[model samples]
Target: MDQPIWLTFIVAFILMNVLLVGMAYMTLFERKVLAAMQDRVGPNRSGRFGLLQPLADAVKLLGKEDLIPKHADKIIFYFAPLVIFVTAIVRVAVIPFGNQIEIGGQPVALFAADLNVGALFLLAFGSLGVYGIILGAYASANRYSLLGGLRAAAQVVSYEIILGLSLVGVFLLSGSLSVRQIMLQQSAELQVGPLTMPNWFILSQPLAFVLFMIAAVAETNRAPFDMPEAESELISGFHTEYSGFRFSFYFLGEYINMIIVSLFAATLFLGGVDGPGADRYWGLGVLWLVLKVTVFLFFYIWLRGTLPRFRYDQLMGIAWKVLLPLVLLNIIVTAFIRLIGNGQIF
Candidate 1:
């Protein structure tokens, strides 16, 4: 059953704020982590342990002068950043955070909309984000910005195919595209000398997990595959002409996209909200989801600190020649395993 309209609105409003706050802190987390890796002190001036750095950054961005290219398309320039920011925030609606919790003796699901085709919706929305990138670049009236936008579009188009195929193995194993049902299917417990653990897809489809991670990083335009805004090649890439809150919008969108994919990885492969004690306390499930997403987010930061960006040709090669065939094979092999397990094939 669908949630009450009022309740849905309340949940969405709360979740949206949570996402925005999380994105803010993600920057702080990345900076501190990178600083540690490089043997230096990070943002410690704003608040205790630099907890207030994000807020400070937000204030600074807001107070900075908003600039536009003299020859820019005013309407597209104004709306492009908003498009990216809104689309990035909206994809969280279909992700199931936890099973259910009670409030005032009434049971409430932990997600906003439990779409039947949640996976497809994610793909569609993710693809649409490219439009914002392209539009922003074109409206900037800058050659470098256009080149960055083209690279981004090409990278997204290539990686998206592998991203979808990688998840086909999970969908095949779970027999559903709904994120909630997939998590439910993974809820079955395993026993080993009285120790119980959830049966996550990561163990069964390790290859898929690896492929998905790579494709997701590329899709989000992160390091090692962040050819779009590569500082060496294109000065800040597609949003080069944007400043102040306009630039901040694109910045927030990127981090939010990172969070979204991290959540997807957790929910799909790591048995989201399925940690020990989750069954006993619904609130723990939410904590588990958060913990899992945090791990992936940290992993993302770690990669940025550790790995060098890939060359433009190498980026395309990895998507087409490496991840593509591997994911296709994984899907085919998963299907055959399912058929044989069901006694439908020898």
Candidate 2:
């Protein structure tokens, strides 16, 4: 049965809302995680264990005054963050969350949309984010915003080359571009204490995984790679002129973008939501999926806590000189492995 269509949309909407909410709290989680790493106490007053901090923060942002600079381009100014936010969430449609679920006697895939070119689609959507910061800064007409936007565009464009190249190895190994197909291949790879282990691509392609992680962290404009939004120097960077929800939207886009990148990392290298006999056991599948994504989230915070910010020249050099070459080599080596196995050449 094709499902009632309405049910499908409703499920998707609810899932997206949950993801959005979760992304908000992920900020709190990052802070808590960072605090623990640094031997300090994190937020504890907002709620039990500070569980309600994100909500409190959201309320605070909503209550703040909205500001629009008098000299800004009012139209694109308003549209920039929206474009970025929408693109971030919209890309989620193509990624499988926990396989499929039987709801009311119908098996519904847990993704928003399954694209033939799902992985490529995700990459393309990621590229769209560069425009958000670029346009936001450009329209703001502030020197800081404009400079931040330029930095973002350059960073994203440069790092994206490495990002795409890193994935080519996975696509070659799986012989498919669909995210679903890639997950199926990953699921076939492990043996874990009587239970077949989830064959995470991370193990098979360790080099590519490392390269991908570096590129992805850069792509998200995060710490160490956050040259665009350099705080002390640029004064909040691109969103310097933004306030209240307007500022919040940029951040909202950021955390949500983090989720997307983490999930993509999970999907491509972490075997997504697959575990031992997950197809046969409904709950286990969800567990594996969450576990995989959580590992990614943990790594994100760990990097934040452990690594200092990279200088602009150093960042670009790593992206172009180190990462790009490594990615290309991974591709060449993977292609050679495939060819020899197929007896295409010696």
Q: TM-score per candidate, in order?
A: 0.97, 0.95
For 12-99, candidate 2 gives per-residue lDDT tens digits of: 8977897898898899999899999999999999889999999999999999998899999999999898878888888888778766
Query: Which regions in candidate 2 have their CA more than 4 angstroms from the true location?
Result: 190-198
Predicted structure 1: lDDT:
0.92
| lDDT at residue 101 of model 2 (Cα atoms) | 80
The deviation in Å at residue 153 for candidate 1 is 0.7
Question: What tens-digit string does per-residue lDDT give for candidate 1 at 134-163?
Answer: 999999999999999999999999999999
Top candidate when judged by lDDT against the true structure: 1
Q: Estimate every model's Cα lDDT from 0 to 1.
A: 0.92, 0.86
Distance from true position, residue 223, model 1, in Å? 0.3
